[model samples]
Structure formats: C-alpha cells, structure tokens
Target: MDTSEFNHGHGGEPINWERAAGDNAFVFMKATQGTRYKDPWFAEDFAAASRTSLLRAPYHFFDPQSPYDAGAQARHFARTARAAGYTGQKPGELPPVLDIESALVNHRAACPPHTDARQVAALLRHIEAEFGVRPVVYTNHSFVTLCLAGDARILKGYQQWLPAYQSEPPRLPGTGRDWAFWQYTDRARVPGIPGPVDRSVYHGSLQELRSMAGIRGNPPER
Candidate 1:
C-alpha cells in the first residue's frame, strides 16, 4: 500500500506499522513532490515501516510541467529520499518509485499542458544513476497513452506499478511488459489504517519480492 499527505486528511490516522504490515509484503510512501516539498510524516512513517520489517520503498511525485529542470527534480527526490533513510541496500527495501499519474498535472482540466515523455524518462534515468537502483514507474493507462504517446519507449527496462481499479487486471502500455506492482483499489479498509488506504499486490512470491529489492540471501520462510 502507498499514501501521501492528501490521504491523511480523510480519516487517515497515523499508520500502525505492525498491523498494516501484517497483510502487506511491501509498503510505499510519498517522500517528495516536484522539486520543493517533502512529506512531513515521511521520516517517522518510514522508520515505523522499517521497524515492522515490511519491504519498503519511497516514491516521488513527478511534476513534468514544473519550472524546475528535470535533473534538478530528480536530484531533489534522491536527496530527500536518502535523507529520509532509504539506502536501497537493505534486505526488504525496494527501489524508489516514480509517480507519473496525470492527476499530478491537472489532467482533468479543459486543457492540460503537454508533458514531454523524453524529459520524464531523463528524470528516471538520472534518479537511477543517483541511487544505483532502477526505479519503478507508477502510472495509469491514460497518461501512458495520451501524454506519453510515441515516447513510452524511453521507459523500456523499468518495472511498472499500474493502477486499475476494476476487478479485471490492468493492461500495461508496452508490448511484452507486465506490472511489478498493481494498485488494485484506493478505498481499501486495511487494519492498521483508519480510513481508506490504497492497496497493491506484488506480482511475485515473497522470495521474488526480496530478490527484486536486491536482497542477497534466502528470505526467511513466511
């Protein structure tokens, strides 16, 4: 599951890490947005999640139309995430996530500004270089089809975290590509969280999840 400050206001209480990690194998939380803001609860929440032994990852909200350079934004995300204690070296630590949903760009407006897919890709590459681990791409179908049309190729090797709220599985953008994580619902009532929490499923076994996070040894038997 993943959360940000926006979700906290809607009956979202401080997360009970042990209770939340009971049914979840991985947890993702927003660390930074654009090039300016850091989530106030990130440091505390991250430490809590780590203490629970849930495989954890921090995501950055991408703002393609922001005035800052893409490289700058990537640096901001890496620096903030590292400062928040994401070493990308622990057994249960997953790579950083890049949130590219259209909601970040006001896509519902009458006329959304064009987002350059190349620039987005550049940011991802820069982050990968900075962190020494390939980041996961979190995006919805529409953004991939519309804003990133003809340019999705730049994201060729990255794992995808797709959100499709239907009962059916999501259809990913690239040919032969599959989802590494699937955000199945945003209104899920998880035990440790007070209100609705976005829930996702890792697309592999516990061992595979550990491997994806670059953990070296045999994972403790679940």
Candidate 2:
C-alpha cells in the first residue's frame, strides 16, 4: 500500500521490498512509470516478494483533461500490462485499478498526473476486453464523491476499490459503492519492504480477493 508503489525515482532511493513483509494483505504496485509501467524491475521485484502479494496491474491515474475517461484507461491498462509481461486472468489476482486522486485531480506543480473519467472507463474496458477480466477503480472518498459520482453508470459493471482508512467503509446510498477491496489503513508495516508504507488489508477471504486480481494461484514468493 505504499503510495510510491507507482513512482519510480524517489529521492535517490527506490522503495524497499522489505516493506512488503508487513501485515498488509495486498501491495498495489503502480503500473505506470510516469504514464507507463514503472519498469520490469519494480513489477518483477514486487512480484518476487514473499511477505505480501501484489495485484500486478497498472494504475491509471486518469486525466480529466482532453480525453480522460474509462475507455481510454482500458487501453492503457491492457496495453501496459501486455508491455509489462502480464497475461490473461490468473486464479488468485485482481484486475487493474484506475487512480483518480490529487495527482490527477489537483495537478499541482509538483505532481505529474493523469485524469479523465471517460478516458479511464475506456481504458478499463479496453483492459477487460484484452484480458477477459474486469478492472477495479482505486480512489479516495473525496475523489469518489466529486469525480466518479456521476460516472457510476459506466462503472457499475466494475468493482470499486476504496482507498479509505476506516474500520468500516461509509455507506454510499445509490452510489453502488459495494467495493471489491477496502484499503483499511494508510500506515502499514510489511516485511521485505523497508519502512512504514501505506497499507491496505482486504475485507474478504484470500480466495475472493485473488479472484479479483486475476492471479489464479498464490503469487510466487512475494
């Protein structure tokens, strides 16, 4: 759950996989390295770790500009995963995720971002079309409320992965927010990874969670 799971260069030091050995159930490795897979090393390393498991799919931090939408994201996810060496649905893994957050929502001078609900939905669709598995949407409560509220119609078919650090998720009436995974905490201690990382444990059994990630078997020792 380390937020930097998607970032490549971080102040001269890449994230330590030792952090992956914490109590967290899932480690979401960022699929994009500034808009593309962070690189084989990141994915391979996380994929190689043991203390924790990774849903090795690209994170599409959607761009609300120009052509930002779900459809565009499907292509991004599918194409990126293909480029990164991921194949069709696996038994115990979940699908890709669309990250629509501050990086994309605010576009601050310090942050490089991507956002576009329509483009994202498109990208997700494209990913599912290519892999035959659905993609999940990852975002905070505010982003969900502001950006995705109206777009739920297109996303109802997909699973929502909420990035909220709550004991229990807030009920979203009519939002159809029945989430696939609930990221319970931002602060987590994992093994194999070095330092305190943002972590999230899944709410369901290992079987249920794995099914969503599209990883058929227990990921290889990571």
What TM-score do all the candidates reach, one by one? Answer: 0.89, 0.69
lDDT accuracy of residue 13 in candidate 2: 48
Model 2, 55-162: lDDT tens digits are 544455555444444454455556666665565455334566666554442553222234435555566666667777676767555554565553455566666677
lDDT per residue, candidate 1, 1-222, as tens digits?
897766565664577889888877888999988778899888888988989868899999887555336788888888888887887777678999998866534435221253567668788888889888989988776776667773466677888888888864555555357788888899998787777889998888878898877776776664
**Deviation in Å, model 1, residue 190 alpha carbon:** 1.3
lDDT of prediction 2: 0.55
